[model samples]
Structures are given as structure tokens and as C-alpha cells.
Target: MTYSGAVTVGGPAEVHELADLMISKAAVGPMNNNAYLLRCRTTDEQLLIDAANEPRTLLALIGDDGIKSVVTTHRHGDHWQALAEVVEATGATTYAGRHDAEGIPVPTDVLVDDGDTIKVGRVELTVRHLVGHTPGSIALIYDDPHGHPHVFTGDCLFPGGPGRTTRPEHFESLMSGLEAKVFVLPDETWIYPGHGNDTTLGAERPHLGEWHERGW
Candidate 1:
């Protein structure tokens, strides 16, 4: 079956395999948060994005192989509801955006910022800091050597528009960041969001102007 990137809580995860990496996406928690498990095909080392909720489900997906690290995209409570437990269970190193690290209950082992590289076995993901939804919200970019780039956008982006922001300034900041950082990628770049279904840059690129105009 094809990987549609649409997952439901308590349902099986959707898997997308690339040249050097395999991505498993699952929806967990009442909020329907999306958690992604990325395993390096060559080295077999794994990195999990967002220990959102349901440690048992996340752990089951991880199996006995245990992952190397857990990255919380932002400081949102819903995004890290299961952080402590998942980290406790796996003893995985914790990483979060530098500014929002203090907001998360678990002590972040590594404070990541824009341009930082996170390694999952031999695969390196480039971190792009996107502000607005949270002061330190981040997105991870994996430039597959044999394929188009794939981005795991936390709450910073979605299928139709950017993440929610409280202030006009925040909305502008997010839009600017999206235009400067994310939109620059090729249209084929696959975007796996923090929740719900996945979308590509090409599908959402034309709506950037409309999203900014709508101020959402």
C-alpha cells in the first residue's frame, strides 16, 4: 500500500520509505498529534520526532530496537504529553528548540537552533527554526541524496496554512519564516506536519499568499 500520511489515533501507522531512511508516522493522543519515527536504513539507528502521547503505542512502534533520540518540535503541552514517559522508557537523548526548552517539563539534553544538524545513524537532518506558533518551534529537513527533500514540520506549517498565532506580529513572523526558509525548497518536497495529513510544498505553495492575507 502507499503511504498517505493520514493516520488515526489507535490505528496503525503509515510508513514512507526513502533511499536512506524509513519514516513511520502515527497519530496519538486526544489532540490527534502526529509522531514520526525515522530509522536510518543503513545503520538501523532511529530518531523519533515528538513523543506526543500514548507511550505504549509509541514504544510498540519502536519495538525492542530503542531509538537514539527524541525531538520535541516545540514547547506545546499537547506535543510533549508523553515526553517524560517515552524518554524514561527509552533513555533516549532529548532535544528541543533552544528558546522553548525551558517550557518543556523534561530537561532537554540538547538545545537545537537553526542550521543545527541532528544525526539518526548516518543520516543528518538540518534544523530550521520557525517562530510564531512558539518562540522555538522547529522543522527538520532531510535532503535525500537520491530523492527530493522531506520536511517534518512541527506546528509551524500545515496543509492549508501556517500554525496558529496569537498576535499579528507573530503571524507575520511565521509567514516571513515560511517564505524565507520553507517555501524556498522545491515544490516536490514532502511535508509531514505535526498533525493530520501530509502535503507537499507544491500543493501549498500557491496558497502562501492567501494564507498571509487571511492572517491565520
Candidate 2:
């Protein structure tokens, strides 16, 4: 189930310039969240990222192969609102950070925390907690032994922005999360952001200081 060949993202090809372009930007609200299907290009087993507003999109992506699990990044309506329906439709096990576990509309079979590992096919995502946007903002990184790391950054990092921090106390938490959890990783990780365009760990490294100075 290792996705060896090129994993073509099914979305706008203009992403080479933008930071991320996987999720449909136009589909927002009750229909706007970005849910991803992490499938082995060579197998039927798959892991679902955040469920979109249209739970049917999550449903349509399924086949006899079956959805193994549904992992939510946080409690934002945009991230997990359709989760209840997805769970009902697929019987998929759910995973979320402990802080936001209660917010998951579906029953969570497993509760994850920072440094946790969840595998789908050959992809083993090491979950990290970056909780400024919410109480349990989480990020997942697919660590390929030799290939580039693929980071599932819910709302933590953006093409030209990072997750927002509205309060002074939360600012340190955000910075610490970025510095300890995100910045500590190799510079080659490919960022798959929750909102807009995609970027790389290298591309975003320079803006850390500015983001901190701006104060959330």
C-alpha cells in the first residue's frame, strides 16, 4: 500500500506557485470544509482526513474497499461538522486529539495526542498538537523513510499565513507549537494546509519570526 509513484493531487494544478491547492476553495460552510481521502494508489484501504460540509463527498469517495478510519484535525465546523454523517454512513473508526474529543459528533474509537502514530496502508502519520486556533489543534505528518514528509496542517500553517492566535496566553502556545512541533522537522516536508494554497516547510521557515512579531 505504499504510494510509490507520483501522487497527483486531484485539484487545481496551479498549486506549484501557491502553498496548497488540494481542497476545493469554493466549497465552504455547511459545504465548505476540506476532507481528504488518504488512499494507497495501489490498494483499497483508506484513511479519511477531515470530513467536508457535504458528507456525500466523503461518502462518494468510498467503495467496497471501505474506509478504515476518520481523523479530525479539530472541532471547527469546517473540519468535523459532517463527521456525524460520515461515521453513520461508513462505520469508520474516529480519531481526534483528546482536548477536542468531545466535539467530535461521532463516537471516537481512539483518542490521540501529540506524538501519537496512526497508520493507513503504508502511511504512518505522527500526530502533533498545535492548539492555538482551538483547544486541540492537531497536525499530522506522514514520515516517509526516504521520501519527503507530507504534513496535514489543519489550520496551523497557510500559504502566506499561520494559524491565528487571538490572545496573549495563546501566543506562546502557538509559538511553542510551531517551534517545537513544526520547526523541529526537516525542511523538506510538503505542507497540505486546511484552508488556502499549499507551501513547503522550507518556504514557510522564513516567516516564523515575522509571524511571532505580528503577535498572532
Candidate 3:
């Protein structure tokens, strides 16, 4: 089941830019996981998020740019299929939610919690520990200087609604976390999910009540 639009070399076509930070994304692997390469325009330091799969493809995206860190958004297997390889090749520090640290294949160098800040060159990404998608699902929020706040929502939040959950309690937890932390932000916030196209807080805002009522 090969997915189309697999980006290999000089790929990850530019997705968006925030201040001096440039975001590039590539759809890779059978699962079509989105691997993002975030580069700091000022210092050239980069941070690759999700290292999801296709090590060779991800390596091409990294190119000669030095990666300062690789952050796994959650404990899901699909999200870290190439983590070990990427880490070995780049020697970048690995970060994950402390609770989900044991689930990832690679050793986590840094355990981040809510409110923690991760530095990519001069930019700082605030960590939001959103649970439900996984016990320790987290999202990284970057306040774009030229635009709205950009959030990397691993699988917690999506375009239509919150991520998939089996139990009602998990759904409630996810909704509450988003309400308290994410939904309160400006409506212009751009949402980059774990897979597929991106959305905005404003775009999904109107459906919050619908999601709650539907019990998804």
C-alpha cells in the first residue's frame, strides 16, 4: 500500500514560515506519516519532529543541516519508526513526554512536561502535555513572529475533531486538555497534525461543541 507524494530529496516542500523559523514537511512511509524539518533561518540549526519513518528519506531532508534535537510527539509506533536511525546518524538529542518515554524505541535524552520550553537555535517551543491520544501525548507550540501561533499536534487534535480514542473517559480528557490549553489561544493558531493536511484553531473552533455532543 504505497502512498503517493512521497518526498525524498530536496523535498518536504516548504509548508510555512514563522519569523526566522522555516517549516518543511514530507509525507513518508506506508502510513503516510508527516515528518517535519524545522530550520532556524538565522542560525541554520534544525529540529526534526516525528522522525516517523523512512530513514533514508528523512536523512535526505536533514541534508547537511545539523539537527539539534528530534522530538517524538507521542509513544505511537508509527511516530518513531525511524527515530533510532535518525538519532544514530545525526546524534541529535531526543525528547519525549516523561510518561511515554519508555514506549519509544530510542532512549530519551530529555523528558519534557507541560510548560517546558525546547530551544531550536533562538526559537523556543512551549510544550503542551495533552493526554488521551496516548497517556503522554504532547504538542509543541511555536509563537510565530509573523503569523499566528503554530502547534504541532501529534495526534491529540486534528482538523475535524480530537484524535481517536477508545474510551469515553479518554475523549473527555482530550477535550478538557484542549479546552484548558489549546482552545483558549487565538483563533488564528495554525495546527499541524501528525498526518494529513494542516488546519487552524479558528477553523476547528466552531466544531468544539459538536465534538463534545457527539461523544467522539
Candidate 4:
């Protein structure tokens, strides 16, 4: 089946296969958080993005292969509800944004910043810090040599608009970051968000101005 990127709590995950990577996306927790498991095809090395919730479900998806690292996109409780448990079970190194590391109860083995590179086998992901939804919200980018770029945006972005922000300044900051960093990519870039369905930059690029005007 084609990957639609739509998932529900308790539902089976959707898998998207690339030339060198296999991505499995599962929705967990009452908040319906999306957790992504990325595995390298060449080396079988794996990395997980957002432990989210439902430790059993996450572990089941992980199976016995285990992961090398678990990256928390932000400090939000919903995003890392199962962080400690998952890390304990898998013994994976924990990574989180530098500014928000202190907010997470679990110790961060690696404090990542914008432009940092994280490796899963031979595949490398560039970290993009998008502030607004959280002080240290980040998105991971995988530039496929044979295809379009893929981005795992935490709560920083969604299909309809940017993630929720409490203040006008925050909204502006998020908009600026998206334009300067994310939107600059080609329109074919696929966006896998922290929640809900996926979208392409082309589909959302037209609405950037509208999102800013609405101030969400």
C-alpha cells in the first residue's frame, strides 16, 4: 500500500521505504503523537524520533533489532512520555535539543543544536532548530540523493499551518525559521509532522503568507 502518513492511537504503523532508509511511523498516546523509527538499509542501524507514548507498542515496533539513538524533538511531556522507559529497555543513547535538555527529566547523552549531523548507519540527518512551539523544538532533514528531501518536524509544523504558539513573537519566530530554513528547500520535500497527516512543501508553500497573517 502507498504510504499516507495517517495513523491513530492503537493502530498499526505506516511504513515508507526509501533507497537507503526504511521509515516506520506510529501514532501513540492520548495526544496522538507520531513516533518515527528510521532504519538504514545498508547497515541495519536504527534511530528513533520521539518515544512519545505507549512503551509496549514502541518496543514491539522496535522488535529485537534495537536502536542506536532516540532523539526527542522537544521537551514537551507528550513527546517524551516514554523516553526513559524506552531508553532503559533499548539502552539507546538519548539526544535532545541543547536548550530544552534541562527540561526533560531523563539525562541527555547528546545535546544537539541546529546544523548538527546525526548518523543512522550511512544515512545522515541534519538538525534544524525551529523555535516557537517550544524553546528547543527541532526538525530532522534527510536529503535523499535519488528523491526529494524528507523532514521530521516535531510540533514546529503541521499540514494546515505552523504549530500552536502562545505569543505573537513566537509565531513570528516560527514563521521566520520556516521561511529561512525549511521553505527554502524544494517544493517536493515531504514533511512528517509530530501529529496528523503529512504534507509537501509545495502544498504548504502557498499558505505561508496566510499562516503568518493569521498569527497561529
lDDT of 2 by residue, 102-135 (tens): 8767777889998999887655789999878788
C-alpha displacement of 71 in model 4, angstroms?
0.3
Clashes of each: 0, 8, 0, 0
Q: Which 10-residue window in model 1 sums to the lowest lDDT? A: 206-215
Q: lDDT tens digits, residues 135-182, model 1?
A: 999999999989899999999999999999999999999999999999
lDDT scores for all predictions?
0.95, 0.70, 0.88, 0.94
lDDT of 2 at 32: 33
Instruction: List the candidate numbers ranked by lDDT, top first.
Output: 1, 4, 3, 2
Quote the positional error of residue 68 for candidate 3 in Å: 1.1
lDDT of 3 at 210: 100
lDDT, candidate 3, equals 0.88
Q: What residue pairs are clashing in model 4? A: none
- The runs of at least 3 residues in candidate 4 whose Cα sits more than 4 Å from the true structure, single-residue gaps closed, are none
User: If ranked by TM-score, best first, what sequence of candidates would result?
Assistant: 1, 4, 3, 2
Candidate 1 vs 3: which has more lDDT: 1
Tens-place lDDT digits, model 3, residues 37-101: 89888888999999998899889889987698999999999999999999999999999998899
lDDT of each residue in 1-216, candidate 4, tens digit only: 899999889999999999999999999979999999999999999999999999999999999999999999999999999998999999999999998899999999999999999999999999999888889989999999989999999998899999999999999999999998899999999999999899999999999888977889
Candidate 3: pairs in clash = none
Off by over 4 Å in 2: 1-32, 41-43
